[model samples]
Target: MSTRRYPHSSVSPEEFHKWLSTLICVLNSVYFVLNMITLQKLGLGTMQLAVATFAGFCLYKSSNGFYRPWHSYALLISLTINILLSIAVMDLVAGATYWGLALPFWYYSLFGLRKGFIFSAIIVLSAAMVIFFRTDTQVFMPYRTIFNFTLVYCSIWLVCHIYEVQRQKTSEFLHSLALQDDLTNLKNRHALKADFQAFQHSFESMHMLIIDIDHFKNINDKYGHDIGDSVLIKVADALMQSIHTKEIYRLGGEEFVILFKNINDKEAFRQAEKVRKAVELGIFFSHNEPIKLTVSIGISSLRPEHEFTDFLRAADQKLYQAKREGRNRVCA
Candidate 1:
């Protein structure tokens, strides 16, 4: 099944979960202590207290370590349990049942737009059922109470939904600005560094090729900066079309890099050569005149001992070698 995408944040969802989990644990501890000290005055029983303690422990446990995608599932299960407990205690407890009101915010915050909405609906329906039966004990008349509760809860959900949707869009926009080149709309160095760090531990091997435009300064000097920008955009389009499995980065100025995953040196060289030829033969127009350009590429394969910086340095050294040997060529 397809899922809705949420806003991108510099702070990852896992980090958010961890921090929120800690917050929940703290709040649960406070509630647990209050219940114990108050001696059943708030209508909290041993079972409710036990569940609160367990939930606190689980949330605290889930907050530590690298983010596992399944962590949210555990959180969701914990929340479901809490909702059920809240409903079970509603008839006995006067003010305690209102814990269900917080469910909408928690659901939408943790799960994003679509799944969060479904979970929120379930909690609301479950709470409504309990309130429907227990209306005699409630202060307000039955229908009025239900109506007000439903209206207020739905309004809160709607506000949270709109806020989250906007937050998601903002996140996506920020993420794009952070990782993407403004000129070519390709991945930038920051994205490359982030991916390299994430992969360096597990990946056995990787290939990199650094492509530099030949006489790039001369092109800008003769044709002005407008044509130079156009050249970069067209070259980016060509690279995007030529590569399938690899990612392309415009690593500032007229330099670009392509990262090839799990590829051999010979295959990497072939790919680099293909990119060089594609750019060389690719046509560009400047003021109705043809503008021709070529790129020099340097290729490197990852070594077990090499860090990202070392691997990048090796590729950059080779790129300079290609430029030194001749203008449009590949060097390894």
Candidate 2:
């Protein structure tokens, strides 16, 4: 799977929580008002309706606070209140269809699908036995009441499943896009930054190398941009084949970076030199023809107290210095 950028798509779990919380508020508010008004008009009983109404109001308040760190206790208390209230007006004959249906969706949102299904199955079956089976009055139905109930319940479940799948797919796609480089099929810089930060905190010694393809603009100028792109891809492929896949990235234009974690200065420098020689010695094929090319590499490592980017900057400066000395070499 690969990630591609699209507007309004967020990959982070924190962002998703905000969206889900807001959506829950909107849905509960609209349904709560309509259900409260309709249930009161039905003359099911006022005390039960009053309690349910109060619970709905509380749910509206607590669920709407998106900034509050998610704790199951607050939501669980509200859900218990709502469930108890739902039981108050429960009946087989024309109680509240939406009220029953809302619980499954609420469960789905909070606890994930399998758990949601289990909880929903328990709630609905309890309602059927204690409320539906026990009541003499008949619930509203089409020509065939049993058939209609099955159809409606199945449809509701299917819709919930579809929403869950779509959300999961969109989120997965968004994540892939954020981490990948479209041009070279390597990780993008943002992903590189995060990786560097993680490695920085976890490891006392981390090595960073910045590799820039020599005279890339000249290649683009001599050949077409497409051939130049092919050259970049070849260089990236060489790096991938020569080193660990997880550590490589295409940092924009002809520049690529690698971070070797838990490796000391000597081994890291050795690895970078190996990659630099491999890239320099390799013959790149652009349009089925061999083209000679080389890459300049600068290697640096994190000091006891240095920002992650600073360590990389040392390598970057050395890479330019390599160009000054001559294009096809490694500098550390």
* lDDT, residue 206, model 1: 90
lDDT string for model 2 (43-126, tens) is 333433444454444445555753333433244444444544554455445445445556665555555557656766666555
TM-score, one value per model: 0.80, 0.73
Top-lDDT structure, candidate number: 1
For each candidate, the alpha-carbon lDDT, in order, equals 0.76, 0.66
After superposition, the stretches of candidate 2 with alpha carbons farther than 4 Å from their true spots are 1-77, 88-94, 110-126, 129-133, 136-151
What are the runs in model 1 whose C-alpha is more than 4 Å off?
Answer: 1-43, 51-93, 135-143, 201-204
Among all windows of 10 consecutive residues in model 1, the one with the lowest summed lDDT is 1-10
Best by TM-score: 1
TM-score of 2: 0.73
Cα lDDT for residue 4, candidate 1: 21
